[model samples]
Target: MKAIVFGSTGFIGSHTVEQLILKGHKVTAVVRSHSNVAFLQSLDVRIVEIDYSDTASIKEEIEGHEVVYNCIGSVGLRSKIDLENAVEIDLTKKLVRAASLSGANRFIQLSSIVVYDFHSSEPLDESYCIKPQYLIQQLLLKREEVVRKIGEETGITTIILRPASAIGRRDYMSFFSRLFQQHMNDQFPLLKNGETKVSLVDTRDVGRAMEWLGNYPFPKGSMNLFLLKGFDTTWKSLKEEIDYERGIEVTICDLSNIVEDPVSYTLNTFRTHRVWNDEKIRKLGFTTKYSQRESVKDAVQDFRDRERI
Candidate 1:
């Protein structure tokens, strides 16, 4: 299979490219000229710089690629919502349109579980009602809408994957990175007595799923969505793993009452027990291979290596 991935330098995108190559597929990474390609250069994939503003140019780049994987996203906690939308929604619009025009067989979009009502009393699935409250969640919802709507009109097979909080070696900027840094400084805090269960999926597992999806046969013009979750574990357990990795006893702080960054922390952490049902994807012969503990250990080591701790 020949595939092209946008935002190939990002946390998830890099892993996707790696897994695809390991599976013996031809992969191409589409990135901007100003973006860093150092890590991408290490992989056995072709790298191309394209101007996303021109849909025709994007189409030209996308042509001859059987599958187009969109791992582009803004995971920054404090990014302005408009900027997030521009990257998440506007840029995605161009990419999907180009894929449709380029005769691509499938378009896989990377979405988040936050698009669902995390306040649900039961586990979330594809059927759960979407009630995105905050700005980031709202933009994600819009992005999904754009993909599905355009996919239907263009008669292209589109798949939307809502992955849980992704963590691993390449997690440069995300909640887990911040959490690790805070833990290293003994400033990490917990909500609900550090027993809040977080839905986590390894970035490697996410990449493997994308590789599997690339081979799965789907009817033309069909749209499918799935939730991907590796395992669910509590903050206390995760913190202990990190504590063991760093060889330091972390002083657990409780911020349940304060809720410092309510918007980001709420959804990222103990906001109404954000669990997901990924049976749909699992039934399709794709399941998580890495556990939360393994991912946490890898992340801790990666951070230490990068920071020279």
Candidate 2:
């Protein structure tokens, strides 16, 4: 197998690249000029640095690859809403166009589970209609639509993977990472008494899911969407698990006292139950290696080993 991975320096992308290499696939990783490639330097893969703003360059880089995996997206607790919109909307459109033009056999897109409406108590599936609330959520919804539309028109098989909050090693700046850090510093906030449920999946599992879908046979001119979630738990349970694993009782602050920021916007997401049904992916023989408890323990230990906490 030959694959090209964009956003290879990111948390999820890095894991996917590692899994692909372990599966004995030839891999090419695309990154930006200033991206830190220290972790990827020792991997058995080719690394290409290119300006993503150049569509022609992206098209050229994507050519001759059997599979193109797009893991590019905005990260952080806070960002310029406008900048994020452009990256999720414009850059994604460009990548889809370039991949279709490059004649890739399959295009796998990394989407978010947050695209589903949060008002429902039942777990969401791939068939759920998108009702995004935040600016970032809206951007992701648009990205999914654009990819499907382009794939349908170009006769390329497109697979969309919407994974829950992915947590694992090397995820230094994700929401979960920041939450762990804040807990260590005694500054973590609890929203609505931490009653809302959140679905989570380990980055390794997410990577494996992508690898599985990459090799799965998709009928010509078809687009498939799968929701990937390992375990579902309340915010309070997640915090308790981390505390028990670390042997420390971290203080949970009042959400009302926290200042309004990007982090606050993210915390607002947890005020509602956001769980997804993984039966769709499970039917395809996808199994998660780490449960929610195991993932939390591993992530906290990784943070400690890296001296991040």
Candidate with the greatest TM-score versus the true structure:
1
Worst 10 residues of 2 by lDDT: 75-84
lDDT of 1 by residue, 1-309 (tens): 999999899988999999999999999999988998988899899999988777888999889999999998755546677844366678888889889989999999988876765556467789887776677777788889899999999998999988898889878787788788888789667777777666788999999998888888878889999899889887777788888888888887777666444556354456467678899988878878998779988887788787774
Location of the lowest summed lDDT over 10 successive residues in candidate 1: 259-268
Residue-level lDDT tens digits of model 2 in 1-309: 899999899999999999999899999999999899988898999999999778899999999998999988654435656734466778877888888899888899998775666558677888877676676677677788888998988988899999998889889777788788788886666788888888899998999998999999889769999999888898888888888888988888777566665454465666768888989889888898889888988888888788853
Clash number by candidate, in order: 0, 0
Tell me the whole-model lDDT of each prediction, alpha carbons only.
0.84, 0.84
What global local distance difference test value does model 2 have? 0.84
